[model samples]
Target: MGQSSSTMSSPVIIPAAARHTATLIFLHGLGDTGHGWASAMAAIRPPYVKVICPTAESMSVTLNAGFVMPSWFDLISLDPNGPEDRAGIEKATNFVHGLIEEELKNGIEASRIAVGGFSQGGGLAIHAALQYPKSLAGIIGLSCWLPLHKDFPKEAKGNLTTRLFQAHGSADPVVPFHWGAETSALLKQFMENSEFKTYPGLSHSSGEQEMEDVKKFLQEVLPDN
Candidate 1:
């Protein structure tokens, strides 16, 4: 599928109370804006970590029958193994990479940064972060699967020490648990540390237990001073 022009607004930012030493760029899923996840960021982020949530541009999604919504890329097909949207994925990756660069320019080292997302956003997180040029602190994927899986072996670079935390609901209908587990397995080949967790009767959304796991992952990877 063809991609649209690159456009972005000022991200919804939750700044740290003290001097910032780390950054987390979290992306929201399809049909959702950055604001939707702002409160979650506020709750889970560490005291010295600033969170950056960028709003995906509104676009017509093919799977949604051309309905306009905020999406990182066009969901061309619901089939997990169908041909992926390479163009749209590349565009979103560049956009997210820009955000990481901006943080780096502001003095946060790549080692102190993490990128994460949920559902569609989570797919992009694992896809892009593995291919990102610099090593990051962590990669968080919640209730989401990996996209462009085959391309990783050829295009993946950096972030060897970066830990990956992927959690999926075994009962999730949107992104199946098997897919998440498979992605986590593939990630283990590239990352030195990777963890995968499954919530027994949970659905496509996150809950307190998942958040607690995420909090622990963040603390272990990007601890506050």
Candidate 2:
């Protein structure tokens, strides 16, 4: 598989308001590209802090019968205890970490950059934030799971200061409610104010009301204008 780059082509959404104090790094789900979730960015709001949606290196997913797809990892199932490609997950984590590093090198401070995603993207966000060296503006995951079932890194308890806003659709047939419950509980076991919202009757995709919730969460997590 091709290794990830410090910079990748992304579909970006720039807020017309003044220069943003922070940049939001948006990662897409399995089988989806950077541009796939550009739809969600629309409801995100005005004076847009810069939003960067990056595409993953294309690869085969055994779960998808070896079909090459843009993904953070090959997810075998939404079950928290299901099979996973640990190596693939680690590589993806490194790639995401590299993206964050590149952004910092380009002038966005660690505290001013927020990393987030949907489904598999959400899983990766949790993975990198826990492993990150410093606190970030925030982390968001919509209909996602934890990357692995392993114990949280000991350093994670102390290093993680990033505020988490996790939202899951109660009707999400892919990822079950239990997964979101456990993930949220796990976060609370580690950090202060790791927030979780279960959208009643919502399905795999976010609806307008839920999307508005995301906007509110982002605005709350981001620094004041």
Candidate 3:
């Protein structure tokens, strides 16, 4: 339960219970703060991993009628295609990338660090992880799709060895399940270690089954000594 301000808008961090051998930097969805998902530390129960949940800067969202809220980037539309917010996404990508570098400076290798998120944050996780220059332990996305997926081919080589665990509720409406599948399909072409799971009757959020899967994924990718 310690806090540090790496940026004007910093994240809520839960230090590892045992030795801090790994870092899990997770992003929050639109309109949510880092504290919103801070409980993930307990849910995952990875004693060797430190959890970092960064808060997104407040900004007006086009999908929400331009009302300002905490968002990783602006959503020009929910069309799953253009009118994309390229500039905003790039800024957030760099912001998250900065967090990765901080962990690296603290002695955590890129292969021992994981990045994940829900919804908008999940999409950014996929976008940023693909563009990151080093291989990561894993990438998790819950009920989110890849933003700018068509451009992934040119960028796939950045983290080809990074594993992915993406799950979507079949009934997800905000970010349709089909879109998530499409992203998983494309990722499998270059990211051979990726896996996508489906929750038959869930919605836009997660539940016990999904959390269990995440725990297993972390244990597999960020194993203890």
Candidate 4:
């Protein structure tokens, strides 16, 4: 699928190589289209897992001097304590929920679907999975922090027990390494089934080891049925 004028760009769909027992809905980072992560995700996903990489709608990002780009929501600043775009985050999270609902309607159980992404998309994925009405199979976030972190554990209603694999580069400059650690700590306060992995010397991107860990996590959480 491709971009559209009235809606979000169509996702890059990688069909399951075997019987489709699970689905992974992955989102791309700011300024990036779904294609950015499609191939990598396709390569790492299990044979029974279908991967869907969705492109975010293009909009003017506040932090980029209002430059129009593909973003899940407007990033006001990198400051963890700074103001957040609550409305925009909620809207994007709702869109994620809609995607999950679509998968559910297509006969995939909520427990057979996972939501994941990188950077900004990963933050949105974390927020969306926590607030979803039904528990998901898993959650994966790489080099990302959680959006609206202050309201969590209380606002988090679903997927508390679902397995989560969060990886961060220790030297990440965009989404600081500290942010990922702090997010992990916050998640552990309420969710016991979460793992936070740190890649040494890495910066702002995924590594071979990290993807291997993610692949293992996916295989464990969405095993063949």
Candidate 5:
């Protein structure tokens, strides 16, 4: 897979091998760089689909005892009902939107793009995709839960009919398995195309089966034309 870094914070881009018809913008988890998911995504994506893996900015995470690390937003607490960094989330969401806008400028329709991520990144993807003003091809989330879930269906004005694939391990410790199930349920309240899968013995990290599922989801949603 070809790789290039145009700027200090630029994403690790895997250009489409053939005519670019679709784009997948995948975000990395906390403390990880875009390079972490680059090769994996490239292996699964079709030649006509360009993969863009964007790294999160470095910031101090309260959950990590104020240690600086690459994170999409500040994790003030792990409590599902605890305080959230709304400002930080908004900033990151705007950044994701900017990436989508750039692809649109490059002639890729909003419907030809998919946004997804893992863990913290996955939460951000769900939040950003739901708030996006245009319809996206799909949304993928792995081992993730919605960050500010209270404002849903109402705040989620766009992509109501868009397809969503969310997966979580039954033994996930970081983000409880129930959170994923609840998120799927909440999303289903308005999004009829949502699907949630459970991994029997999986943990906080992804497995071979999960990746295969993601590959199929990508193929189904962003098929080559």
Candidate 6:
């Protein structure tokens, strides 16, 4: 899926049946493609919303038993001290920004777009939305960690009063619920009324409740038509 020498391919526009200008740009996780979690659409479907799902550049997924799969970067280790692929990170940032610009060009306001993802993709969405320099309609992360290791610049934080919906299973092994909680806290520390909910017994997979939460988030963030 490396259409360019970057960590993210261009957005694949999936038009909703209604001519809604709002967009949800979804990024998938490690070992997954854009289509991997496309089922999220059904959970999010409302009249007049378009969703863009982009595949990450394919890289050999070493942590997942060395199987080659689509991924944003190599997680040298789970430790903070581990090496990181800076190039991949930069490419991902650029690709996400490019998608936002293109969506605005297509007539959607910056405030009409939300970014959501699962796992590593979720991490990217958190980082990207925090730096997006304008208020988003919303941001959602499922089964992913917060990218607070990188600071969100002051200007973006000032403009980001947008709603946030984050759901993580309390018993998730890959991404602990605490991560989501901390991200929510951090967001509220800078913005207003960011929402975070944790499912008590759910796992890394998005439970039905979490998907329902996404609908609620969209209902709260999207403009009433």
- The candidate that wins on TM-score is 4
lDDT of 1: 0.87
Q: Write the per-residue lDDT of candidate 2 for residues 124-179, one digit (tens) a residue.
A: 88887887776788888888878874657454633365688889989988778778
lDDT of 1 by residue, 1-225 (tens): 444454566799999867999999999998988998888877988889999998998889899999999988888887767987888898888888989999999999999999999999998988889779888999999988778888766788766567888899999988778888888888888777888898999998888999988888888889876
Off by over 4 Å in 2: 1-17, 45-48, 77-79, 153-159
lDDT of each: 0.87, 0.76, 0.87, 0.91, 0.90, 0.74
For model 3, how does the per-residue alpha-carbon lDDT over 8-102 read when each residue is reduced to its tens digit? 47679999999999999888888989998889755685898999998887777898999989888788876766788887788888888999999
lDDT of 2 at 168: 92
Each prediction's TM-score versus the true structure: 0.94, 0.88, 0.94, 0.96, 0.95, 0.86
**Any residue pairs clashing in model 1, and if so which?**
none
Task: Indicate the TM-score of model 2.
Answer: 0.88
Q: State the lDDT of candidate 4 residue by residue for 68-167, as single tens digits.
A: 8999988998899999999889989998999899889889999999999999999999899999979999999998999999998889878999888999
- RMSD values, in order shown: 1.8, 2.5, 3.8, 2.6, 4.3, 2.9
- Top-lDDT structure, candidate number: 4
> Given candidate 3, what's the lDDT at residue 4?
23
Clashes (candidate 1): 0
TM-score of 4: 0.96
Task: Please provide the root mean square deviation of candidate 5 (C-alpha atoms, Å).
Answer: 4.3
- When summed lDDT is taken over every stretch of 10 residues in candidate 6, the lowest stretch is 150-159
The TM-score measured for candidate 3 stands at 0.94
List, residue by residue over 135-215, the lDDT tens digit for candidate 5: 999999999988789988778758888999999999998889999999889988988799999999899998999999999
